[model samples]
Target: MQVIATAGHVDHGKSTLVRALTGMEPDRWAEERRRGMTIDLGFAWTTLGAETVAFVDVPGHERFVTNMLAGIGPVPAAMIVVAADEGWMPQSAEHLAALDALGVRHGLLVVTRADLEDPSAATELAQAEIEQTSLGRIEAVAVSAVTGRGLPELRGALARLVAGLPPGQPGPVRLWVDRSFTIKGSGTVVTGTLAAGALRTGDELDLTGVAKPVRVRGLQSLGRSVGEVHAPARVAVNLRGVDKDTITRGAALLTPGRFLLSDLVDVRVHGDPVAGLPATLTLHLGSAAVPVRVRPLGADTARLRLGRALPLRIGDRALLRDPGRHHVAGGVTVLDVVPPGLTRRGAAAARALVLEQLDGVPDVAGELRRRKLIRGSELARTGVDTATFPAPVAGEWLADPAHWAVLQDRLRDEVERHAKENPLEPGAPVEALRHRLGLPDRALVEALVRAPLVTRGGRVSAGGPAVPGDLIRAVETAFEGLGPFAAPEANRLAELGLGPRQLGAAVRAGLVVQLAAGVVLRAGAPEQAVRRLAGLPQPFTLSEARQALDTSRRVAVPLLGLLDSTGVTQRGDDDRRTVVRG
Candidate 1:
């Protein structure tokens, strides 16, 4: 589907032309029909070849120009209907200026009411005026709804006009509502040009300025019910859980979490910001026109504080108008959706330096670099797709990849330094490591350390001097000669120069066994005991275990206790134990 909004002087036959094209009435209110003018927006659609093109008829009266802006702001394509008799009037220029400020370039210059006067001159005049604006030279089609002159040609041109337009914007869903109301049985319904992206039935979307999200009960595109609707087309959404009174023009229906919402935005204007802006202004973007306060940072850049939070993307162009002073001040190109507060000294200058780094589109990489580390949710709200985003140090904390690599190296060096300096103490505590890296997240510290720098018991250190090569050789040789159940005597261990520290180290390193004091046994003694006991009985006593393993009570008691501690056995009430053979 395609949508085009009408722009021209009052009573220039914009609505009349729409009726002639669609064969449907464009006026929805009695006052509008009686007054012979569009007081608010009206909608109509007609089939142009294989496509259905929806027409948004906007009023041309200067008194309701803001209402006119609301109707046309979201429609990508337009039809500027100029009455041949009134040729190129004030509203014609103002409407064109609004479109120009919004950067709308795809449209047709239509000369309506050709029966009253020759349209060639009017067409030429309107075309020349448009040439001076962002909508450069566009061919004009002369037509009369009264005489049906050039109606067929106008229809073809409208189709071709939409065809020549650039492909629709690609992004998540954003529908700027122009009209919202309630129906007897259908609940709340809001109509707008689905400006970008798509939505489906039952999809929950965040409505800017409203805290609660609304769900799509049903969807209609170009006035037909559908399960889903894509953008750049007229959409009437049947919404659930929200009242009609709560919705208004400028409210945005967005795919939740994809777009940033804020009351303040930093922008780069087309001209000098200080000279081109008023203290109080109206900001018009998408389908919204809201009052705002501007703070100029430079000739081209400034910050805007809207009446309420609105969703805007980087590089979005908006019209800034001083209602009491000037109609169109300048076009504002958004540079940052999340601007910093200027409460501190030199904050303005510091902010300007940050703004200077931004390019036309958002500099996500540069932003991550500047912050060093930021919450993943913050970046998500920036609408930067994380699937295509660069990898971070850990989940939910974004960091510059190179910076994170540097952090890893720094962490390793610190751990190595701590261990070399304090070999007796378990490396440095996690808290110290967290502080050294200047990281607020403790989990990042835990993820950075591994291997030679070991982590255990609320501390980190290099693994115990690699188990002493000489002790490894001595213990392995002695353990090979020990009996399955019988133990190594303390005198024998001392003879081999294995002191208490050496034996304890061997036990911790999984090389030797110490069941109790003077009851050191073979390394695989527990495994041998479990197997022999599992075959002995349903439950076995310490006497039976010692008899089965042919080991003494001194070794047997602690070995059973070790088995129980390791869950190899479960002790019953009568002091007997059973093998937990899994």
Candidate 2:
């Protein structure tokens, strides 16, 4: 299905044309029918060729221009109606300006009431006006809803227009609600044009501004209930948790955790000069109309602080209107959703220089270059495809190549400084280095480790101070005279100058193993003890093992505990331990 919105002057037969095409009344209210004017948005649908085309009929009067914008905001295509007798009018120009500001390029020009006068003049005039806007040189059709003249041609043109539209993209859902109401026996029902992504029954959707998520109790398209519906169609979703009053127009149903609700954004203006725009204006995007404060950054770039948070992304298009003047001031293409603060002197000008280079297209490389470091999920939320970018520094944490190189250099410097500051404990704790570099995750520090640097036991080391040659040889000689498990006592260690610092260096260099605070054993002593114990009768008591290795209770106890912790031995409930022979 494809949705098309109607736009024109107040009495230009926009609703009449839709009614004639769909064989249904486009105006729903009895007062509107009685008054022969559309005061609000109306909906109708018809099958054109093999495709179902939904029409969002909007009011053309100046007072309800806001309602017109709401109806046309979410639809992809449009039919700009102009009465043949009236040619072009003020409201026609205003509606055209709105569409142009929105950057809506796909549409058809319909010269309505053709039976009343020669439609050629009106057709030529409307075409000439449209040629100057984004909807350049669209297909034009002259039709009379009264006599049904040229109705078939209009339908064929609409069919071709819908066929030529770009295919709906699959991604996180952002359905802006245009209408919300309660149904008898059913909860709240919100209807809108599903521009992208699919919706399924029972799907949990996040209602913007609502604390809790709402469940999709049911789904309907073109007045028929369905289990699921995809994009480019008009859908009415039955919600379970939210009330009708809570989920009003402008409220959006979003894919939870898939969007970034931003109150401030930097944008590139299309229609009007940024310097001339008012300080405050109404911003229309999707089905939302929000008041915003504009801060001009450049001739065509500015920052907009919205009245409320909206799920915005890069490349999204919207319009700004001067509510006092009752006219669209300009259109905006979102350049940056999570923009940097412009608090410093000349910061706004500098940011404008950067924003001028952005074309409002989501480019992974360009975004990474600008942001330096960002989460993959954040990139996705801002409409960037992380899969197309380079590999991340750590899990989902991307860094620009140049920035990553700088971080690596800084990490090396920090490690070297840490080693010099604390020679006895040369290795820096991973958490300490992470905090020093202001890195968000410890894994990033691990990823930064390179040659001459190693991570072990939660510390990053730059190959700590080497054990002294004399101390190494002396410790080896002292161990050679003792049994495998006969760890040196504190007095013996002191005699060999094997203090805590020396023992720490030796342990890091694999010269000796320190089992406990005061117990030191030769390297490979635990393995040797395990082998000796495996030959014991299945399970041996601690005393038996101590005697077997000819070591005291202190050395034997820590050795057995180390073996057990390393899965080389297991302790039984009987106070006996067995070596794990594998």
Candidate 3:
């Protein structure tokens, strides 16, 4: 099924034409029929040449232009009505401008009320006006809903118009609710034009501004219940978990996590110059009419601060209207949903320069280049296909190749600098490096480690300048002179010239381990002590381990603490120590 909206001036026979084609009243309210004018949106459908076509009859009065915009925002095709006697009218031009702003291309120009006057002049004039907009040159038909003159030709033209429409591809569902109400037995139902994707009966969807997701209890298309309905169709969804009073027009049922709700957006202006637009204007997109504050960045680009967060994407076309003046300022193509803040001086100008290069299309490579780094899920939320881009540096963390290379170089330099600054502890902690680099995840830092730089035991280091063999040998010879647990005193180490730097080098080289200040032991002394303590008994006191190792109290305390820290021994609350066998 395909949906089309009717656009024309008030009393131009738009509803009459729809009723004549579908053999059903397009207006639902008795007041509308009694007044002979459409005040709200109405729906009617008919089968045309083996294809189901749905008509969203919109109000053509200038006062209800907002309602008219809501009706045509999601419909891809339109039937622009022009009365033969009236020729062209104000609402006719306004609706046409809206369609052009939204980029609606497939439509038919209908000259209604043909019996009142010759429709040739009106058809020619209306066709001429449409040729200047996005609709371009389209099929034109003259018809009289009263006498049914040229009705067959109008239907044939509409059939061809619907046939020529591009097939709707399955994608993230964003259904803008035009009407919301309660049914007798059902809880709540929302009717809208399903522009893309498919809706299933049991699918879960996120309703805008609602805390919890709503379930699709049932689905209906063209007044018939269905399990699933595809895009380009008018659908009424029976929703669970939300009340009719809360759900209203302008709220959308969206595929959760697929869209990004943004209050600030960067857009490229079309139709009118940015300088002519007011600072505050109403933005119309989907079925929403939101007030916005505009900050002109360039002649064609600007930043819009919306009153509320909306699920927007790149390349979305919408209109900006001056509600006070009752005129459309211009059309806008969204270039960035999550834009940078313009707080610094000249930042707006710089952003405009960058936005000038964007074409409003979702290009993953372009996005990565601009953002430098972003998560895969965030890129997807912007309507970009992450699969088309290069593989991420870490899990779902995409980085530009050049920027990633720079980060790797920076990481290497930071490690080298850290070693130079603090020779005793050369390696930098992983968390410190992550914070220094402003990386969002520690895994990214781990991925940045290269050949010379290595991460081990939660520290990243470029294995600090290999300890001099002479210094390592000196430390080893000093330890060999004493028992395995007999660490030399600080004064004794001074005699051998084993200062903190020398001891640190020996530790890095695995020749000696510094248990604590002034407590240096051979590399394997902790393990050896654990083995000796394990033979003593199930649990031994620190004094008993000290006696068994034959070491002084200073050496024995740090050694036992080291063993406990390294998981080689467990100390109970009673101050008894036991070797951890496993």
TM-score of each: 0.77, 0.83, 0.93
- Please give the TM-score that candidate 3 achieves against the real structure: 0.93
RMSD of every prediction: 6.2, 4.7, 2.7
**Residue 499 CA error for candidate 3 (Å)?**
6.2
lDDT per model, in order?
A: 0.82, 0.89, 0.90
How well is each residue in 34-92 modelled by candidate 1, as lDDT tens digits?
A: 99988999999999888788899999998888888888888877898899998999889
- Which ten-residue region of model 1 has the weakest summed lDDT? 419-428
Predicted structure with the largest lDDT when compared to the true one:
3
lDDT of candidate model 1 versus the reference = 0.82
Error of 3 at 273 (Å): 1.1
- Name model 1 segments beyond 4 Å from true: 168-170, 375-377, 412-424, 450-454, 457-582
lDDT of 3 by residue, 102-173 (tens): 889899999988999998899999999999999999999889889989999998999899889988778999
Residues 1-582, candidate 2: write the lDDT tens digits: 889999999999998898899998989899999999999889999998788999999999999999999998988888999999999999999999999999888999999888899988899989999999999999999998888889999989999999988777788889999989899999889999999999999999999989999999999999999999998889999999988887778999999878889999999998778898889999999989899999999989999999999999999999999979987998999999999998999998899899989999999888988998898988888988655878878998999888889999999999889877866563888999999999989999999999899887788887644444676787886676787778777888888887887788788768788899978888887778887888889789999998888889988888888888998888999988887754
Residue 296 CA displacement from its true place in model 1, Å: 1.3
Identify the runs in model 3 with alpha carbons over 4 angstroms from their true place.
Answer: 463-474, 477-480, 494-517, 530-547, 557-582
